[model samples]
Target: MALEYDLVIIGATAAARVAAIEAVNLQARVALILPHPANGQVHPQSDFYPYALAQIAKTIQTNRGQIQSPSSYPWKYAYTAIDRLEQESSPALLAAMGVDTIFGTGEFCRRPHLAFNINQRYLRARAYLIATGSVSDYPIIPGIQSAGYLTLDRLPSLVEREIPLRWAIIGAESIGVELAQTLAKLGCQVKLIVETEQILPYEDLDFANLIQAQLEADGVRVYLATIVTKVSQENRSKLVVMGDESIDVDEIFIALPDRPFIEPFNLAGVGIDHTDKGISIDNKLRTSHPQIYACGNVCGNVLGGYHSQSLTQYEAKIVVHNALNWRKIKVDYSSYDRLPWAVYTDPPLARVGMTIGAATNSPRRDLIILQKYLKTCPQAILNNITSGFCQIVVTRTGQILGAEIVGQNAPELIQILALAIQQKLKITDLTTFPCLSPSYTEFIYQAAQEWHTYNRNQKQQRQNGWLNCLCWWK
Candidate 1:
């Protein structure tokens, strides 16, 4: 029997949760499908674990520096907290909302009418949203299949049960660097293995190098510009190889974002467009098929080109509105640049909007770049926490395009930048805005004020060059 509903949201990601809740609010019957029995969002293995590990590392660093504890790593307490976070969602909550939560794989059917086959039951909805999120991507290293390794999603389970010791993370992207630094700070010997010369490659080149240096300073050995060709187990230890050189470790961690989880739907049979990257979506998040929509990291419209829970939550709202309402309101993702993202390191890395790469390809040709290092800031010196800088990109007209920070309270500072960019606030406005003296925020004001000095310097340099060229010609 085919159960009818107003909406059917595939997967149990945060995006799906939002659509389910909104459908319940509209008094529409909604079916929410899960890949497994466990809610992926609350699972101990997902995004929650790396975050838990980072906080534990911070606590360890704080206590050791303060002389409160001699041991730098403590997994016992952190695991306890992680276990608490894994508590499954109450069934009563879903029941109260009237959401039919089915734990099974769903395949869309093309025969007769548009419907999904979940287990043996058929569900036909007025509209469908594909919010299945992403699946993990591992490197193409030989002997990796037989050699057991841990992905970020499965990392919490490893930490919860095993003793903290030797760990070699195979990828220094956001998650890799974050977990590598975390494990190192928590008394584990960590080697961050990446093929790129710099960590956080998506960030500004300078910012990426700065964070890589910070990782090294925190006792993480970063092996850059070389891929792990092979991984094998030797004498109870995992050996990772890069050409002639090799290192042995207890575990290998995959700390990269996931590929879009859309292949199972067999979208091509129904004429929905997608590639290995993800499903293609317009500015309004509509799929090629008029009846289907895709959201979250499963779509090309992902603002940062990374998997983001906050982004999933935001896009979920837009998806639900357009899916159910008679008058489909176009999605306005203009403030997508304002979405603040932070990597949880000792001195965190956070950024928003265009990177140096983005500005180069942008329509705004006359761009101004302003940067200020925290080492020169009074607050950083007083606090003895000065491993950071603030960089901002803007147009000639002073419209803030992007900002990046690497420093204490960087995650918080980026928020101000996010709000400023969202409101289209100008550099002069930030510089004139009164802020507490001897604060990290002064970095923003200082960076903004540097633009005026940069203009004067540029003019002087041009004049001096012109004079020198005239002399040479004579």
Candidate 2:
């Protein structure tokens, strides 16, 4: 006999599991399919490896004057941590949570009413969700595949062997940037090549430059606005060619854009609109077939930002509600303004909402830019770690439009701003918000304070001192 479910999630990713749990909590029968063993089923917390490695690298960097050699602590501990985390989300645990877990590759069948056929079992559901994640999209450079290279997923293999002495990373996405700095800090020679003019093309130019300078200071050779024409094996080393110039390195790492893993599901059988990017969906996270939906990396450009686990979790909630309930709830990433993202570099770079460049190019001309440097913060001075700044964009009337933070605890700091943006809070709210003395959060308060001065100046410029006093008194 075949099984039936209210929701059939067609992937084993973290987002799939999240939706399954939510569906079960909402009193719906849920089944989660573990697609092909090799599909990109990454644990949501896999990002912990890079973040932990960055911390180890920072410690080594701080004591470089006395330390003769950095230890292998990062590799030794980071991989083990990820292994332990993966066990917690194993299929068995998911099954225990009332998610009828099925392990096998599957495809949609239109016959005898819509169902997913897996190992001769017909799993029928009222609605289906495609949460299959994405895999690294290697560029089509000549001879590169033959020469061989590593992607972000393959970096864990480095633990089994020695770190490459010389490395050429072919992209400047967040992973590439984070690893370049971590590797250089560990005493490896790294060359980062970016086809775009800036390291992080989507971020503000000045913020990108700040991270670039930090990478260079850490001994990374940065190549901007350059394209790799070819890659070839030269004796024991690999040569990456860019027009007339070439770089010789012991290994190459490709960090290009990701291609969604949507092939196996046979999306066409059910008429789900999709492209090379991923499945297309309405704001409510519904596919062309009202009975089906898509979320996470599988949604591709339909969503913004890198593959953020937080954003994926948010999408999962909306998917569960819309799939199980008739009263549909639409997803609004708030134009990606309410969703915060971060790159875990040494000091870290975090942003939410519009950047300075984005705001300037936007049609809104009433926006004001305010900046506060870390050097001026007493906490930063006390900790002897002053290296970055916080910049905020707001309206002339003090409403916060967005924020860019590059400094200690940036990821944690951005969340506060993200919440503020989500609530439509003004700069005055942030400035007046109580904060601990001598803390990194003071950076936000200081930046928000500039709005007060700017407002005062505007008021004075419009009228005499006596008029300004009268206005204030009223």
Top model by TM-score, which number? Answer: 2
- Overlapping backbone residue pairs in candidate 2 total 0
- TM-score against native, each model: 0.85, 0.92
**Backbone clashes under 3 angstroms, per model:** 2, 0
The worst-scoring run of ten residues by lDDT in candidate 1 lies at: 63-72
Q: By TM-score, how accurate is candidate 1? A: 0.85
> Which lDDT tens digits does candidate 2 get at residues 266-303?
78998999999889999999999989999999888422
Root-mean-square deviation of each candidate, in angstroms? Answer: 4.5, 3.8
How many clashing residue pairs, candidate 1?
2
Write the residue-wise lDDT of candidate 1 on 1-474 in tens digits: 889989888875667777788778888898888765222232312665667667766765433233222242355555566566444443346667799888777688878888888889888988889988876775578988788887755654554455536888887568888888877776678898887767776776877788878888888898888788889989888899988999988888876666777766778988888998889887667899877888987784455645667778888888888888877767677667879888777678888987766776677668877888888777888988657888888887888888888888898899888899988898778888788889877777777888888878989999999999999999
Error of 1 at 180 (Å): 0.7
Clashing pairs in 1: 45-153, 73-186
Q: Pick by lDDT: which candidate is best?
A: 2
